[model samples]
Every structure is written in structure tokens, then in C-alpha cells.
Target: MARSKPATLKDVAALANVSRATAARALNSYGYVGDETAQKVQAAAGKLGYRGNRLAQALRSGQLPIVGCILGDIQNPFFARIAHDIEVLARECGYNLVIGSSEEELGQEVSLLASLRSLSIRGFIVAPTSADNNAHLQGLIAENVPLILIDRVAEGVDCDSVVVDNEGGAHKAVEYLIAMGHRRIGLLQDDMRIFTSRERMTGYRTALGAAGIAPDERMIAVSQSTVEHAVDATIRLFSQKTPPTALFTVDSLMTQGALLAFRSMGISIPHNVSLIGFDDFNLATFTDPQITVVSQPVSEIGRAAARLLFDRLSGKTDAPQKLRFETKLIVRGSVSRRG
Candidate 1:
């Protein structure tokens, strides 16, 4: 069905028998009008189905009032969820969003940023590629552009960032597994090139050290963004002569790959190999043996990132702020003490 065009200020003015300027002033909240008269104008505008032209207002103001959102690997549930929340919040604040995905490639990320710049986007919220491209990020910073990095932030990149407490979360996850009497634990981590992954690795080691368990480099597997990489790493860890009694994955995808590898190898959760992961997945509870996880406040992170960007756009730039949110250890059926 074809949609009807929205009624304009002129239509409302004709209905209300007031001047166009009076109708606009009432709609835009710009000027004082008699109480009863304002109500009459509002009722007439509502009856006429008038809607404000935001695009025209933006054009006149020379501000698109949009935030450029560039994410890495939109296929990942984590990224997709973040993008969804960002879009919802942007709309609520009377700002539109321009979204792009980099597919975890540095060149694609660079191109996406350039494309957004060409469109005159005043701000960006990005999940950059794990690989270091400090120069590209620094270039944006140098231009005094408002940028808020989420999930991952680069070293020496002086900008506001919203990140989970990766190290603390990992440490708590491993500590919980250790408390459950799992001494030989396997760590399935992402590419250590990223700062968050490195911090998680350190946390894993910290847990083992605090427990007086020797750090076994052999037990740690370096996985990438893909499920194949995670699966391969898990296979290597489980194939050891004395396999780990429990598994801990750094992220949701790695957790899924770990579960798949266990299924393929006919290993029973908890009975054969207890499992826990860092990031929460949508179907974590639906699995036969529900996976335990360190749950991050993803929506809150997105909201924080947007709020930071909005503040900067509102001219609140003073010093770069790095915000980290706490995580929760969600206990499910995935982990148990070794028999």
C-alpha cells in the first residue's frame, strides 16, 4: 500500500486558522502563545496529521545530527546486538545513525571511516580491527573528531573508550573453575594481538598463579574470530595425552567452537570436560548442558558509548575518558568438579 504524505505546517495553519508562523512556533517550542490558543493549534495540527520535517531542519542547521557506527564482524552476535542497541538509542535522541561493518579487516575499517567522513558525520563509535592501526585512529583524533571506541581500544590511542573489565572477568571465571576443583583447565583465547585478548590471557595466568597451579603454556590455545580457528585450537587442547579437565573460552564464538568440538569428540560436558566462557551467547541456556559465562552489560556499554559521543558533540571535550564496566559470573551447568 502506498503511504500518505505527511501533513505540513501549512496544512496545520489552514486547519487552525492561524498564521504559518504561529503553527511553526507552537510545533517547534520556540515562542510563547496563550494557553488555550496553543492547545487549539496543537489539536488542529494533530487532526491534520502534521509532522515536523527533521531533514529540512538538519539541512538548515548544517548538522546531520547522526553518529557513524562502524563495527567489526556484524555476523558475530555480540557485534550485532551492540549495533541494534546503538540504533535504538540514536533514534530516541533525535539523531539518525549511519552503520557500517568492517568484517574484521583493517583495510575495510579504514575505508568505512573514510566513507563516513565524506558524508560529514560528526562523530563515530567503532569497534576497530584487532590488528594495530594506531595511525588511522590518531588521524581522526588529530582532526578533533569525536570518537568513542567500544569493546577494544588501541594502545596510545587518546580517545574515550567503553570496554568490559576483560582481565577481571577472565580472572573470576578461571577462579570459579578452580574453586570447582578443576586444576587442569584449558584456555581458548582470541588472537593475542588485541589488547583485550592479551589482558584476558594475563587474567587466566593470574588465576592459575593465585591457586598455586603452574601455568602450562601447552594448555592455552590461540583462537581467532572464526569458528574454524576456535575449533582447531580446542581440538589441539583436548587431544593432549592428559587433556584438561575443564575448558574456559575467552569469547562467545570460541565458547561455541569449544562446544562443537566436544560434540564432535563425544565428550560429555562436566562429566568429561567441564566448560565455561567469558562472553555470554544467546543460546547459552538452550544447550543440553547450559554454558556458564562471564556476562558483560552489552546494552549498557552501547548506551555509554553513545552518551560519550553525544557529550563530545555537545562540546564537553576536556580529557579522554576510559570507562570499564563490571562483569558478572553466571553459573550454569557447563562446569563442575572433576570426578
Candidate 2:
């Protein structure tokens, strides 16, 4: 059996009684066209099942129809949601999205960026893995690539960014614990080298200072880069003869590890000690003592990043902007009233 050829722009123009130039403008949204004529062209293309060659279109205008998204850990459900939102917005803006994960490794991040650049990705939305290894990103900026940072910011890289107020959220959550008389609250977080972790740690310290509670060195634990490692860290904290009455875990992975450790130690939530998590997810509400969490606006972050990238692509030659979204504390059954 012979396969039929794909539809072409000429076929659409002939069916719509319009010139190829008008059809191209109407379809690409580059130039103004009469509403009725544009509708006719669109309908004709749809009826003929026309799919334009993106490379051809780019050659015509020196513009690519693709953007790339890179993230530190795509396994995080929140990051997954962000990726989905970015993809939807890209499609709506007539650009395709390609995603890659760096796995929080500098080498992987560098390799992914190089590969995406070779693909002619016109813009990038990235959650950088390391603060120090930013020379590669600086190269991208020097080359005049449209870039937007998400979730985390790099050192000395001036670009548009979308991040939640980690400091405020952690401060509020810890202050609430302090108000409930949890003077011996412990903090468990990812490696302090990460920007978000640093901001969150500062917030936790600020809350303790505001309440006149001297922060304990032993209770302040960092250096865990994985969920399983966090389990051991939590155990070490609980093993202290005078342990904290409450625990605040930063990030979803560490929170999961801490919860698992509590279960293994036969500890009761809000009875033996209290718990609060950062970055809310479905499991937070479903836990036995529904977790109190600092919730980031995931969809808004994705949308804002998309808008920033588009602005850059549209020849907005202005100073880069940093957008910080606020986080909310969702009080649940995790904390107990200190009598």
C-alpha cells in the first residue's frame, strides 16, 4: 500500500483562497491578518491535518519554537507538577518543551545544558543544583540565551527567577511551634550548601532567637543529601537524653525519611513529639497526625517562570527580575498543645 503525503501550507492556502504568505502569517501569528481570513486559513489547515515544519519556520524568521526546562530533582512530585504546568503554558504559547533532570550533580547539569543548547532551545527554565558551579550558566548568559531560574538561584548569575519565600515560611512554622511551647524543637534539612536550605535554616534560627530560645547545636542537623540518610540523622537527634519536643523537617524527601524513622522508633506523633514539614504534598494531609507544612505555590512558580522566559524571548532588554512567592502554613493535626 502507498502512503499518502502529508498536507502542506500551499494546500491550505489553495483551500482557503489565500496566498501562501498570508497563510504563513496567519498560522504563525507573526503579522496581522483579517479575522475572517485568519479563521478560514486556520480551518483549512485543521481540515487538511497540516503540521508545519518548525525548522523551516525557524529558518524563515531566525527563531526556534522550542524551550528547555532543567531541574535538580524531577522525582519530587512538586517538581513534576511544575514541569507539567510549564509544558502546558509552552504549548499555549506555540512553543514545544523539552525537559531534563540534573540529579543534583554539577557534571550532569553541565552536560544537559550543552546538549539542550545544541538543539537550538531558544530559552531555558532551570532549578540550579549547585551555587558554586555556575560558570556554565554564566556562559549561557554571555551568549545571550533567554534564561529563567526556578526554585533555586545561583551565585552571581543575574537572571529572572521564581522562588518561594523559604525564610518566611520556615520562620512562621517554627514560631508557631515556639508559641505552642516547643522550646526544644529540632531542625533536619538537606545540605546547607543549597540556597533554599540556607534560607530555611536562617528562618528557623530567627524564630528561635525571637522567642529567646537558645538554639542547640546538637538539635540543628544538616548534611543529609538523601531520604535514607535523613532517617539516621533523625535517630541520632532522638537518641539524645534531652531530645527536642518537636521537629521541623525541610524538603519532602527529608520529611519522608524523618517520618519513617519515627515509625521505626515506635514514637507517637504530637504525643511523643511534634512534626512540621516543608513543601506540602498529598501524603502530608493523609498522615496519622496530618502534618503541619509550609506550602509553596507550585503552579504559580511555573507560570511566572514561563512568563519571564517569554518576555526575554520577546526582546525585553531590561534588568532581570527576581520573583519570590509567599508560602502558607497549613495547620493540621501534627502539633500538640503544650500544657
Question: Each model's number of backbone clashes?
Answer: 0, 0
Rate residue 291 of model 1 by lDDT: 88
Candidate 2: C-alpha lDDT = 0.89
Q: Which stretch of 10 consecutive residues in model 2 shows the poorest summed lDDT?
A: 1-10
Sequence-dependent TM-score of model 1 = 0.82
Task: Return the top candidate by lDDT.
Answer: 2
In the range 191-258, model 2's lDDT, one tens digit per residue, is 76578998899999999999999978989777465678889999999999998899999988888888
Candidate 1 Cα deviation (angstroms), residue 319: 2.4
How many pairs of residues in model 2 come into backbone collision? 0
Positional deviation of 50 in candidate 1, in angstroms?
Answer: 12
Provide the lDDT at 146 for model 2: 89
lDDT of 1 by residue, 167-267 (tens): 89999999999999999989998777677788888889999999999999888888786778888889989999999999889888888898889889889
Task: Flag regions of model 2 displaced more than 4 Å.
Answer: 1-50, 59-62, 223-226
